[model samples]
Structure formats: structure tokens, C-alpha cells
Target: MNTVYIGLGANLNAPEAQLRNALDALSKSQELTLAQVSSFYASKPMGPQDQPDYVNAVAKLTTQLSAIDVLDLLQQIELQHGRVRKAERWGPRTLDLDILLYNDAQIATQRLTVPHYGLCEREFVVFPLLEIAPKLTLPGGQALADIAASLPHNGLTAISQYDEAASLA
Candidate 1:
């Protein structure tokens, strides 16, 4: 099984519930084993200020599926939660699930990018990632804790812990 970290974010349609429901979906997948999950976080949107602040968190899972397959699964989960793709970047969405890392492998393809292109720079992504895996090092050798220390929180705030039972219920 390959260990993977997924970044979850949503700013619309009850954002926090969207994330929790997504987590429940992931846990129900037969090929994926839900592992550690960071506390939920709220942060300002990365692009347009007109959008609502996002609820974000990082999830760790072990999966037998390939990286691309995992990406497909995440996208499917996003879709089920009412995500809509548009031409604009960083626009508000009902759900966004990204594969932040895949078994320490560096990957680049038309469909996806591992270590997520914005992973180190986004406080919502980096800080919650640190909360779950404090000593993690990027595939390229950068220390996650160091990255967290260097990156500003950028108005990110912890909202609540992940409650698996409540989410699944």
C-alpha cells in the first residue's frame, strides 16, 4: 500500500461539512484505509476576496491504488460533494481534494503533480500538514516542520478536530 496525503478545502455549501463528508467517503473506499487527519482549519481564500473563507485540512491514508487512480478517486469525491470546475483559478468551490504527496514519489503529468505545486507556500495546506505529520520531509528533501516555521499562517485558524463518527453518521 502507498501512503498518501490529501489536502481538502471548501468555501461554499457548508464547507466544513463538505470536508467531513469527503473524509467519510474516503474511509468507505475499499482500497483506501483512512489514517491520521489534521484538525479542520479556516483561512482566507487564495484568490478573489469576494468568496467565503475556506475550511481546510490534511488527511493521511494508505491505498493500494496508483497515484493517478488516487487522484481520480479524489476528483470523484469532489464531484459527489457538488464541485464544479470553471475556467477561473482559485475561485470558490464546494469541494477541492488534492493529492499532496504519494509515497514520497515525485510525479508530474498532465493530470496531476505530486507534492502539490502550492504545497509549501499555502499556509492552509502547510500548517495542517504539519499538525498531522510534524517530522515529514518533502520528496525533494525539504523538512515540513521547517516549511511551516518559514511560512506565514496567512490568517489560518484551527476550527475543530476531525470526528469520524459524526462525519460518517
Candidate 2:
């Protein structure tokens, strides 16, 4: 099985509810087993400030699928929750599911990239990721704690926590 980490964010159509619905969809997938989920946080938008802030969280899972397959699954989940592909980079969306890491493997293709393109500097991702694995190190050997220390908190505030045991079942 491949251990994977997923980053979740939503800022439209009842953001928190969209996140929970996406989590439930992922937990029900047969190809993967949901492990732990981090507490939710709300942060300033990464793109144009004219948009609403995002609700973000991270999830750790064990999957039997390949990197591309996992990306495909994530896209499916996003679509199910009303995510549409817009040309605006980092624009607001109904849901965003990114494959942060896939068993520490570095994968780069036109469709996806692991160790997600902008993870190192994003407090929203790093902080939530730390909740599940404080000692995590990327495939490049960068310690997560070290990365966290390097970045500013960036106004991310916890909105809610997840109960792993309750959600796992």
C-alpha cells in the first residue's frame, strides 16, 4: 500500500460543509483507507484578495493506487463537489483536493505533481500536516518541522478538529 497525504480546501458553497462532504467521499473510496485528518483552518486567499478566504485541512491515507490514479480520484471528488476548472491560477473554487505526497515519491507530469507545487511556503498545508506527523520529512529530506519554522503563520486560524477514530470507522 502507498501512504499518501492530501490537502483539502474550499471557499465556496458552504465551505465547511463542502470539506466534510469531500472527506466523507474519500473515506468511502475502496482504493484507499482514510487514516487521520487534521483540524480545519480558515486562511486568506492565495490568489486575488477579492475572493473569499478558504477553509483548509489535510488528510493522511493508505492507498493501493498509483500516483496518477490517485490524482484522478481526487479530481473526481472535486468535481462531485462542484469544482470547475478555471484558467485563473489559485482562484476561488467550490473544492480543491491536492495530492501533497505519495509515499515520498516525486512525481511530475502534465496532470499532477507530488510534494505539491507550493506546499513549503503555505502555512495552511504545513500546520495541518504537522498535526498528523510532526516529524514528517519530504522526499527531498526536508523536515516538516523545519519547514514549518521557516514559514510565517500567515493568518491561518483553526476552525474545527477531526476525531480520527470516529471518522475512520
Candidate 3:
């Protein structure tokens, strides 16, 4: 099984509920075993700050599924949660699931890229990812904490505490 880290976020509707439901769905997937999740954070919207603040978190998992399979599953979860791709970049949504890392594999495919292209650029992703996998290193050899420390002051903050007990239940 490969250890994969996925980034989840949403600004529309019940953001926390969407994240919880998505995690629950992932936990029950045939090839995925939900591992750890960082605390949910409310971060200012990235692209256009006009949108609502997003609730974001990072999830670590062990999966037997291939990268493409995992991507497909994530997309399905987004669809189930009412995510729409028609909006402008970083627009508000019901849920957003991004594959942050898939083992140490370096892959650049038409549909996906391992070690997501924007992982290093977003404070929302870096902070929560560091919380869950402090020592984790990306394919670029940078530690999670190192990357997070390098991010500019972008107004990212841990708004909602991750309900660890409820998530595990």
C-alpha cells in the first residue's frame, strides 16, 4: 500500500460537515484506510479574496489504489458533496479534494501531478499538512515544516478545532 496525503477544503455550505462526510466516505472506500487528519483551518480565499473563507484540512491515508484510482475516488467524493468545476480558480465550493502526495513517487500525467503543483505555494495546505506530517518530505526534498515556515503571512489561521473524537467515531 502507498501512503498518500490529500488536502480537503470548502467554503460554501457547511464546510466542516462537508469535510467530515468526505473523510467518512474515504474511510469506507474499498482500497483506502483513513489514517490521520489535521485540524480544520479557516483561511482566506486564495485566488479571489472576494469569496468566503475556506475550511481546510489535510488527511493521511494508506491505500492500495493507484494514483489515478485515488484521484477518481476524490473526484467522486467531490461530486457527491456538490463540488462544481465551472467556477473561476479557487472559487467557493462545497468541497475541494487535492492529492498532495502519493508515496515518494514522481508522476506528471495528463490528468494529475503527484506532489501537487501548488502545494508549496499555499499556506492553507502547508500549515495543516505540517500539523499531521511534521517530518514529511515532498519529492523536492523540503520538509513540511520548512515549507510551511517559508510561506508569507497570508492570513491563514486554525479556526475550527478538528473534532478528533468525532472524526474517529
What TM-score, computed on C-alpha atoms, does each candidate reach? 0.98, 0.95, 0.93
* Candidate 3 residue pairs that clash: none
lDDT of each candidate versus the true structure:
0.94, 0.91, 0.88
lDDT of 2 by residue, 18-127 (tens): 88888888888999899998999999999799999999999999988998999899999999999999988989899999999999799888988888999898999999
The parts of candidate 3 lying over 4 Å away from their true place are: 164-169
> Stretches of candidate 2 above 4 Å error?
163-169
Q: Write the per-residue lDDT of candidate 3 for residues 1-169, one digit (tens) a residue.
A: 8999999999999998899889888887888998898988888887887888889999999988999999999999999999889847878899999999999988899999989999999988898998988889888788878777778747777866655467768
What's the candidate order when arranged by decreasing TM-score?
Answer: 1, 2, 3
Q: Could you tell me which residue pairs clash in candidate 2?
A: none
Distance from true location, Cα of 116 in model 2, Å: 0.8
> Candidate 3: global Cα-lDDT?
0.88
Q: Model 2, residue 11: displacement in angstroms?
A: 0.4
